[model samples]
Target chain A: MIEEKDRTLKEKSLEKAPTGINGLDDITYGGLPKGRTTLVYGSAGSGKTLMAMEFLVKGAQKYGEPGVFMAFEETAEDLAENFASLGFDLDGMESRDRLLVDHVHIDKSEIEETGEYDLEGLFIRLGLAIDSIGAKRVALDTLEVLFSGFQNEAILRSELRRLFRWLKDRGVTAIVTGERGEASLTRYGLEEYVADCVILLDNRMEEQISTRRLRIIKYRGSKHGTNEYPFLIEEDGISVLPITSLSLEHEVSTERISTGISRLDTMLGGQGYYRGTTVLVSGTAGTGKTSFAAQFCKAACERGERCLYFAFEESPDQITRNMKSIGIKLQPYLDSGLMQIHASRPMAYGLEMHLMGMRKILDTFNPDVIVIDPITNLISAGTEIDVKLMLTRLIDYLKLKNITAICTSLVQRESTEGINAQEISSLMDTWINLRFFESNNERNRGISVVKARGMAHSNQIREYMLTNHGIEIRDVYLGPSGGLLMGSSRDIQEAKETAEIAAQSKNAARRKRELESKLKSLDAQITALNSEFEVQKEELDKLSSEEALRSNALAKDRSEMARIRRADLH
Target chain B: MEDAAQNNNGPELVESDTTPDPEFYILRLYVAGQTKKSLTAFANLKEICEEHLGGRYRIEVVDLLENPQLARGDQILAVPTLVRRLPPPIKKIIGDLSNTERVLVGLDLLPVGEANVQK
Candidate 1:
């Protein structure tokens, strides 16, 4: 055998548990440490059991590391069958001796603990299971079931201590699932004290909206994610969230993607927006914010850059169908995995949870464009300060990652009434406003560029109509009346009622004009007076010389008269 | 869009109804022996569970001494420590099926439910 320094580079590698879940390894800062027990605690129906099992199945299938499942709740058959829904081939894995499901039967009635009984039986069973398949990972579906089965708390606690130490001693990465109990995490709560890492899972329902939350409570001896992240367990399996913690370092590509509408591209100041600029499209309800954002995402995907559309207010299927009618199809892109649509309600989660969910999806797909249609819905879950801070962090994260993040916010009015818009405007590198107006008897939509930094953009409001083809920009509707038509006729009447908005703007303009005219006249008179003063000074200088000569002659005549009188007298 | 309006109305009322009162008593029962005392304790706990704790308590019976290896958990030096777990300031009471007054006080099952007590 070669000496340690003489060995090949592969020999120096650390033993790793490849989670088999995509993007998970990156968030974990590498897979979970080898030969350590990680306690997965969660309230009922929080997907702790499912997450642990998936970790095992993925380990067995993806990496050649066979796994042993020490299930305390379900039978081997029941546990194996559940994987069918997620398309995990347990039988195939078992036949190859790559996976083993050992159900450690713990019934509450089997209580004959006499003396000095440690959890040697459990270790022997786990050891046999691991050795039979040469398994590298182990999962205990629940240690709580065992605690509930045994009445002796003291022994149970000591056994748990042994189990974790035993797992570490054997050099196997293990997941211990437990049902959350009152006050403490697990029913007995000893597992958390002994485990190398602790992860808490929670399923919370707010205002009738249910959400699953995953949090890394503690991870010993290394840096780990500390925030509670929202994860989804659908037919495909579980996906843990995007990393929300800010790190200035992220990969950015020097590329550009077009905003489908050429007019919009022009408004963004040329061929297209920079690869990573976050574009905010804010408009009132019914101004078609969803359609506006969808068009851009559609364009980006068509151009071969992947796009992930997050619809907070609509379902993915519904958005797909809706966009299809507008001639922007998502089905083909989704089929190719070039475009992904994620939909849920904002009230379904807290703001940070929402941010985490967004982060997770972004990480998994690595999309070039992430469109959160109606970020206003997300704001409803947080206070104004919270919304601003979250958005600032989110925008900063997107720009740093160089993923062009497009967000839509619903304004109460076409004009954000100036106050509420100020809160979000500072964070935006570009802002587009969609307006609804009424001209003649027809309702119309107008798109205008509010702000685009570092580039001159179109200032004129362009009327845009969503036809069967796509979003079509009409000519600059510069007619006798400026504002285009929008909303129902009844709402127009309502707008007119609220329209008591100072017709006195004309009067004010007239007064301003009169004041300006008067100020100009006064300025001209002052200029004329300055020239007159200069001309009079020149005339005065000439007159002063002539007067001096006249005075000299008069004095000489007086002297002569005096001289003549003196001579005559002598 | 119209469906969203209808769905919003239903969730509004469900949220108003399911909010829990903050001051409810919670208890987790721990037991080991299956003797007369253990049986009597379980029975007494049931009567207490239905009467004072009703809809508010969560009882988790743990048999430790029988499974001597499991006894170290909850730091059990004795047979029964009824852990009054939540709305806590968690208090633990140890007994063998006899002390009703201490159990009631330990559970905070006093002050209001006394008038309806089947003493």
Candidate 2:
């Protein structure tokens, strides 16, 4: 029994009592300080009471430690009925001798005091309740009501101090809840000052959208996360997201996975993305970005791997119908439950809620692959910093879990392709940029690999077409002006080039029927123009290499990291 | 018993201490044990009833220490608490009952005036 209170992993001086709430234990390192009263304060509807109740209920059910819940404001029946929605069988737990709920209702109008008295009635009731269940944990929700219940503040304050002391002496891990005040943590500003550990929950509205956040104010002798983590109150109770979860701890995978499109796969290191790496595809609207995300999901399902697809702009039905037009039949995978498409609007939640919601889905689905179609719409949910912050931790988590992630981003145009992806591009292992190329008054779709971190990928722009079957990658060909030619302009360029090649090398073209060779030989006959083109290509390569350079301004940043991971093998 | 309570010689006396009282007081004194505070509260209440309500009041001492679960019935929290059971609207008074004026107001024996309304 004593060992239960000593579950601290780091030091023996400070013990912990694990509150069975999900994600809360992860942030508090283990749980609240054991055998000591921890104060949780929040405004009305901030979930302070629910958190405290869950703490006691979880202690009773999971840790085999019976608990006494002393609710100052609500009845035992009301508490039981309220928790039933969260799937906690409070009445059953009480019946099984694992829990005891004592409702202490104090209406100043219903009582008469004829003499000087201490809170001995409260003490006796709490003692009997605790002893009845042999409770190892206790929860006093909204204990600040003592200020309102009793008229004499002097004696009530003294008794409160004594009550906390008595609770500690009893050696039961306890949680005390307080109502949030304007200046102090509690309305009376006493519990926060007295408690060993203090946690603050805030549910505030920004732009008419509310988000619940929890923060640890102080943990007397222990280290805790200080960041304001967002939490959601769902059917399963409060789930706090410890966003400070990942920091360069992801293990790298060398195994390759296919990108679904054969030619597109070839463009990306002749295989596809790294097994557990984040792949980002940035393009303008109607540039086949969603199609790429869908293809990624289909490929995962084909390989008998579970995939989860998050569609932001389209509904699940809409996406299924849209993908059907491109000949990507997702209904079979949907029916087989191999591929799960979850669709929601960007305005539905704050950035943290969306991220936490995805984290929850990721845990339950445990998918091998995840696709977020057009993450650019997430900008509606938060600022650029928020989107970047969410993507950083999300990608790191996915990599740590060894799940392949394909995230699509929609930029404004071809000129702003990598620019829109600038905030997220650095985090991706592979960046696939699609373009809506317009030439000769018509637009065509083209794809290119901007960066593939650990693998060598083709830099050539490959024109692709949406056919009756799906996306078809066309032959790689540059126009006479050394630019990407799309639509009928590409066909016109190709036919004109073919005629020029036949006229220049009738015998040489016959000797080598391949197009690449014919073009190469034709360049041989072009005199000084070929020499000038060679010099230009050389300079372009240097400019491109500088961005990927340790030879440039980014080298100093690399040297610092290189110093950290300097163990015999770089 | 003290000069502080004797100071509030208001209309409660004109109705009860001076005239033949008809309102019977059924008071329940909730105490945890025979502690000094509980005993002091009980003694003070007996003297207050003798002086104020005379033979019209009846005091019942319920020790919560002997029956701990009985504390929940009247939502008793403070030790040595007084419950006015016979009154149409029940009221509670907590503490050592040292402040007799406040106890009178709490038990509806004295006019609480704006203080009761404000609370």
Using TM-score as the measure, the top candidate is: 2
Highest DockQ among the candidates is held by which one? 2
lDDT of 2 at A374: 73
lDDT of 1 by residue, A276-316 (tens): 88778888777778887888888988889889998888999
Q: Which ten residues in a row have the lowest lDDT in candidate 1 chain A?
A: A109-118
- Interface RMSD, all models, one decimal each? 12.0, 2.2
True contacts kept of 2: 0.90
> Chain B TM-score in candidate 2, rounded to 2 decimals?
0.74
- Single out the weakest 10-residue window by summed lDDT for candidate 2 chain A: A4-13
Model 2, position A185, has a per-residue lDDT of 63
Tens-place lDDT per residue, model 2, A336-384, is 9998999988888777678778888998999999998877777667655
Report the lDDT of model 2 for residue A122: 88
Q: What is the model-wide C-alpha lDDT for candidate 2?
A: 0.82
